[model samples]
Target: MSGLGMFGGTTIKYRNPTYTRDHGSLTLTWTDEWKTLGGCDLQEPTTGTDTKNREGTLSQYTLYMPSGSPVADNAQVRVDGQELQVDGMVLRIPDPLGILPYCKATLKAWKG
Candidate 1:
């Protein structure tokens, strides 16, 4: 256990693509699961240069979950019945020595 009771007593719906089956066709199925103690933190926008040396603002968000929580890449996260975009990448912050205590995921997205 992380021993950190900062779940905020709320849950978030996690949706991910399961599989596709058809006659040479692509079918996307979303699997939904309720994750406990899920929290989201929005960070201040950061100014950075783009590939063309153009400055842009990037919004950051950190999603908190319990240790050993199953969160996949490109998964759709819904909080309070609203979907939020998870951009860039999903990073997992584990405990020391890869132990399972608590974990946090950082991603970038725009405000919705």
Candidate 2:
């Protein structure tokens, strides 16, 4: 409720704070919506799949976690910003594409 002419005009500028959706499901604090999901696509020309039998590209992937889901249950969590040190926690991005077309992440807890 700051700028009045902010729909379609050149004089539609405001001086306020800005934020982004970079913090998906990770920021569900108030409600049960904490921690969202990211997207990933898989198609042909990446996984080196046979163009005939095993043809495959970037496999679509998103954020997925169940409630009461133990972080040790083959969970693939991509930790950003700050890193935590846990005795039974392991974070890894299986593919090099991070979250491009084809990527895999495995955040599991190491059983020492």
Candidate 3:
């Protein structure tokens, strides 16, 4: 736990993915099992110039989940009614004593 009380600032929604084969095709359809995850902190989104096209910008927010959170790497997140995808790996942060481990991931959306 962050002694600064950074967690529990806002609510988050996550959808664990379940894939199903399409009939006999090689394609797989992704299905979502939406669940609500509370006691987490969603920081304000920061904008930066789009590296690919420079014409628009990209927005990213850091999400801090509580220890033993059920949020998964393949899960999609919804914050403040905006759908954001996980930009990278979900990292576990632990204190020097290896206790009170928490998870952090970057949620990103492109506005171009």
Per-candidate count of clashing residue pairs (backbone under 3 Å): 0, 22, 0
**lDDT tens readout by residue for model 1, 1-112:** 3355344455767765555888888765675564533543433335531232334434555676666556666666776665654553456666677544454655454432
Model 1 spans with C-alpha error above 4 angstroms: 1-8, 19-59, 97-100, 107-112
Q: What are the per-residue Cα lDDT tens digits for candidate 3 across 16-100?
A: 5555567765542335556888779877666543555676567788899987777766568988888887775688787678655
Q: In angstroms, how far off is 83's CA in candidate 2?
A: 14
lDDT per model vs. reference: 0.54, 0.25, 0.73
Top-scoring candidate (TM-score): 3
TM-score of each candidate? 0.50, 0.16, 0.72
Model 1 global lDDT (CA atoms, 0 to 1)? 0.54
Please identify which of the two predictions, 1 or 2, would achieve the higher TM-score against the true structure: 1
Determine the backbone clash count of candidate 1.
Answer: 0
The candidate with the higher lDDT, 2 or 3, is 3
Candidate 1's TM-score: 0.50
TM-score-superior candidate, 1 or 3? 3
